[model samples]
Target: KSPQCTPDQHLQTQSETQGLESAQVTKPVEETLSSLSALLISATANPENVLIDALDRKVAFLVNFLLMKYRMKELVRKADIWKMIIQDDEDHFHEIFLRACEHMEMIFGLDVKEVDPTRHCYGISIKLGLTYDGMMHPPEGLPKTGLLILILAEIFMNDNCVSEEEVWKVLSKTKIYSGQMHFIYGHPKELVTKYLVMEKYLEYRQVADSDPARYEFLWGPRAHAEVRKMEILEFLARVHGTEPQSYPSQYEDALRDEE
Candidate 1:
């Protein structure tokens, strides 16, 4: 592994980053970020090698692609990536999405539980390309969170039938029964957003949402409690199914300790 001092040191981070046309340097970094994402596609895939410290697996992914750009092979060479993506991981789904975010920037647009205690989750989404059979996908390595995909699919479906305003209104509706219903299903608060409500109430309300020009924290996290009432035991069971039992709920607890 490379030294964790790229911010302060002037050395090439990896072989992929070592040589490049000045114009193509960013390409290698991006490719390195995309390699090794294929490891997450199967039941046998290993993520332990993905992130070891602060360094993201994207480093490996980017390097792999940078090394093989001329070969023209697909990112997920065996199974169609889209098919794997559509099959949701019901537990630790957010954990999966965070992995994808390292390789793909597009997935970075959706919301989840934020690390900050003071922050409330917000609703946000974006889809690039207007093809009719358009697929919503994350960067090469990101695992899809079932909840995020459901929200995107619903919104995408709505795009074909209703105005964006109508879609947003319906998805953002907060009902009196929301708490009661949380016993069986997780509330959609973190995954769905009321842009108007978010803009008016959250502290960073004025910050621009993601777009071409800015590094936006487009999505935010919402605890099940903020928008639902499930027992903690159920929550623990679901998250642990996807998370390693060895360090289960580490990220979830990070949210609490930050409090």
Candidate 2:
């Protein structure tokens, strides 16, 4: 027969087992803290990296703020930006603002124009003559720049005008159907027929003396002023992986228009 274990021995064994379990649990936590401390040390060693990282965050914040203003059709003020982002840091304000503006222009195809120097009021506008808005992978509150480009190109390709039906046909091919909700563009029909019309990007009007009163789309005054036929042709060429000269008639027409 085996000897019975004493109460003290049993208590001691339980204590040892508990100690071992506690150590096992604590080891990973200690290791994680050590790793984090090393990372912090490495980051602190490179001041430039820290500065760049901070600046990038500020720039991203400013871009998102400006995009929000654009979506709301509101003007941005220098004072407001300083108050919001710069806070008591006037020394870095100019650098941050310039970087943010450059990012806005390069990535969103937006121009941060100073509308009023005295009041320090700024207005955002789309870049002229460029169909691409760098919106291939847009962040929050993405604009409908790509859709606008496609519609403008379609109109240019179809002899400077296209019927509403034809416009819908082209848009449908891109999975943007009329009266349907798109993740990015909202309602395609309303966006095209109403908002774009109001913005003077496209002129939608009743076709000439049609019995059923069909509508047609034409390049609006704003579109004509902002973009050119050649630019539109080049945009199309890029999309098709071909040269603008591939379409001889359109190329000639663009040249004549340019001349």
Candidate 3:
């Protein structure tokens, strides 16, 4: 017969086996617990990121919608934007709309102005003092507002009038040639000499008694009505990273113009 085991010995052996099984079981449980903890942390951290991403998507949608309305020459109603993007988030309508407007102005050089406060209707216009022409054809053309501003600034700098040659020289530095069709602003020559003139933002006229029939640019009636000298000076100063008063002559002239 096989050797007989004592009862205590059998009990001890059984307990040891159970202990080994317990050890084996504990490790996987601990690993599972750790994984769950990591998942919880990740879930907790993701809400803010998710919110930001959602907000950005909404703002983009609103921007594209606004651009579409502007291209179609339709009035933008606040209710429509709310319906499209902020359907249930009524509290965040203003915030989202503000962000969209800021994006339009900053990126596309466009402004969303409140055309009808009672009806909450808005209209798109070119930034930097252009309140006319909401139709930026093709809806994808790059804005010419910046170029217009630069031209206006040049005119202001050159004793309130700038010659065609001088303007072309300045534009050449920006890689904009006269006759070439630019990818953004179409033909620079026609844009400057015709469209802007027709818009009443620039006055291009033949210089008096020039044998070659030269032209000069001056601030048109619309420019005078829409923008002030000080505002342009401040814009230039901001570009140069200086105060508007740094240019003493222009500053004084701007001050007088303000008065």
Candidate 4:
């Protein structure tokens, strides 16, 4: 003899039964998580293993390749996978990743296009260009960092050597007045000491006989490696309205030497 049950009461009973069955089904999966974690710990315990190390390095390489080939936003759809795979601090990952890119660029001439400018996807470094006349030019509409560095470099192009104090004096005399007495902050001498010297845009050498603070700066490896003599000569020709063939004797010699 069963009591009559309303439709609502029957539905509630059914729901409760379904919940119990679902929990029972999930119980094994929940229990296995701890075991899975322990197994993972055991697998990764010997980080020095050749295979494990190889796999770790390969994973890092692949991650960099993907980031370079595809826009970051497109690749980040699987952020969870990245989080687990990277397993390092974001800054560390980026530092290694950049070094990997720079290495590839140096060895294989491979450039990474990680961003779609119109799509608002990724951040990229803007390259500063030096015109033939040795003008430090950024792309249009960007803040100007001045041509003091480039001008200094150009003046010393032939011998490619100068003292820091001499450069500072020249820079101090040179003025850029776009507005009412807007001065360039930070002495050029200090800028050379702090950044250019370390970046290898300019090579600095000091001898025991020389002044302690006085270091001679010359064009660094990067200057020769990146800036072609032909390009500079071409720019000069354009600026001066002369044929590339009839350039200055020094520039002509440079071109021939480079060739």
Worst 10 residues of 2 by lDDT: 1-10
Give, for candidate 4, the lowest lDDT window spanning 10 residues.
133-142
lDDT of 1 by residue, 40-144 (tens): 232233657443422233333322332232123223321222233323333533444455443333222222222333432221222121111112221222222
lDDT, candidate 3, equals 0.65
Per-residue lDDT, model 2, residue 92, is 85
* Candidate 4 local lDDT, residue 176: 19
Superposition TM-score, candidate 3 onto the true structure = 0.55
Quality of model 2 by C-alpha lDDT: 0.65
Best by lDDT: 3
Estimate the overall C-alpha local distance difference test score of candidate 1: 0.27
Best by TM-score: 3
142-161, model 2: which lDDT tens digit per residue? Answer: 76665676677666665566
Q: Compared with the true structure, what per-residue lDDT tens digits does model 4 show for residues 1-259?
A: 1112223354365555433422322233233322322333444465564344433353345434443433332422234334554555554555545544443222122333445545433332312243221112222222122232333334333233444444443333333122223222233444455455555555666622554444555666655565555654554444345666763553665676477
Comparing 1 with 2 on lDDT, the higher-scoring candidate is 2
lDDT of 2 at 13: 54
The list of candidate 4 runs beyond 4 A from truth reads 1-149, 152-156, 176-187, 211-213, 242-247
What are the lDDT figures for the candidates, one per model? 0.27, 0.65, 0.65, 0.39
Ranking by lDDT: 3, 2, 4, 1
lDDT of candidate 3 over 54-144, digit per residue (tens): 5556666787788688667799998888888788978777777887776565334577999999999999887666775423532234455
